[model samples]
Target: MQKKVPQIVFDSKKPENSGIEILTIESLASRKTEIIDHNPEKAHQVAFHMIVFYTQGESKQLVDFVWHPVKKNTIIHLSKGQINAFQFTKKLKGYILLFTETYLKNQINNSPKNEYLRLFNTHLFSPSIQVPQDSNIIRYFDLFYEEYNNHTEDLNQQNTYKSIYSIIFSKLEGLKQFQPFHLKQSKQVNIFLDFKALLELHFKASRNADFYAEKLNITYKHLNTVCKATVSITAKQFIDQFIVLEAKRLLINSDIKSTELAYSLGFEESTNFVKYFKKHTGFTPNNFKKNYL
Candidate 1:
């Protein structure tokens, strides 16, 4: 018997109200038992964006099967569709803001849509940022928290909240510019970004670099050159990394049988999938499952 991964949908029953919610880490920790009483060990696939700021205390969370440490003044963003589970201490203190895609599109109208896509879309790096407990960054979050809890439903209030939200991300983007691995703007970088988008859409059906190159209207050699220049990895390596990542996500988050998992990942034969997994990870499927699960 195979168990399915739990998919959590945002509460969309009230469209008139803003599609956003905010809570403090302390508040969430108090209700931890009530929240996880149903399935304590299951990782939830959230259907909304989660922005977490850790102002104090230390904890850890599993995002897409990778456990990230949460320290003071740290910010973590979890885009929609990522599997996550929390392990926080009782002293945790911070804010957790959950917003739906609708809220982003409707409320944050001042920023371009591509900016949102670039920030929220976690492909090349972990969607977490570390910052000194500077007053400027803290001020933006404080304003957002106050606005979120004000309980005002008027248009003017909504716009005010949206403005504060935009400022938070704007500052974060500025910090990202100084990151050592930040992708620079160039023709090669653009091609790599396009390749990643296409891979996300077609990885389940096609893992060939040539297919992606055709979709990008670029030659396979050019795609490989761009990938090597941008990330120091070849184009085919990028495809395999995406496939293996999804494989691990499924293996840890669900109870699907090995054969079914393999087939779902576009493998025609289960043995081939096992071999592929072993070649990349140096562990058989069963061994990997035993180690992680």
Candidate 2:
């Protein structure tokens, strides 16, 4: 028999890297223990823009449904509401900068929209770039650390914060190099983006193809074709996947009994939820938690 993979839940409270709080930043730095067996039980939802800048470490970033490696100097940009995870390496060295999206928005509205956020979002899975230790990049970060250290000071507080956001954006744009995935979007891609947004919000309650088709104002056949063209999964499958993920989350993360879990998940009865879970996963809820939890 093949050895089963271990699915571990990373406790966020312990051994956290500090730079900025989830949606707020003022120059943060820390080293983390390896996160190999750990999986964050919930998606990190925040209004801030997060930049995980690693120096001498590696991490696997789970973005959407794909995992991407992040090595030194190359930053991973996670926009607000994007579901992502940080699986840290054993030897981790880096500063994680978490600033409100508003900070970047203010600068972009005044200046050119920063190219770094744009490029990074497009090429999220590409290989990392190593920044030279003695380079100006390191020197620039030193200044960031200094400013962050002085954040509590009253003098020039507003100006200092403004400058920080501007400097970071400028540095990211200066790294101009990007991968092929950074191409401008096509019409179909835009439509798919909208579809994904809808699915994220309504997947639990809307399980039928016609439900989404009516909302998108398209025929069911057209909706299925669009979903298949982009994601290769039918709309119903996408809905089921979302529901299943939620089921797994509730099962593993909560202390609630299975009967309650079923009802809360919108099942008409506890038995129905148990049956649905068994059909999809080949095991009952208790078995899943026993083996995987």
lDDT of 1 at 53: 86
In terms of lDDT, the poorest run of 10 residues in model 2 is: 23-32
Clashing pairs in 2: 19-28
The 10-residue segment with the lowest total lDDT in model 1:
35-44
- Error of model 2, residue 108, in angstroms: 9.1
lDDT of 1 by residue, 1-293 (tens): 22455667676333454777777877766766786433323566788998888988898877887788988877888888788777768687898878988887775476865567557757755677777555378787788778766765666876676778888777876666655677646787677888998888888789899999999998999999998888789999988988988897788667778899899998999999999999999988778777764
After best superposition, candidate 1 residue 235: deviation in angstroms?
1.3
lDDT of 2 by residue, 1-293 (tens): 21222333222241322324322111121212333443342233334556666766666666543577767665666655444566655675666556555555666676664354343443222423444444466555556666665535466655665666567667665554444333344555456566666766776566677877788788888777876765577777766766776777666555678899887777878898888888888889888777753
**What is the overall TM-score of model 2 with all chains considered together?**
0.60
Q: Which candidate has the highest TM-score of all? A: 1
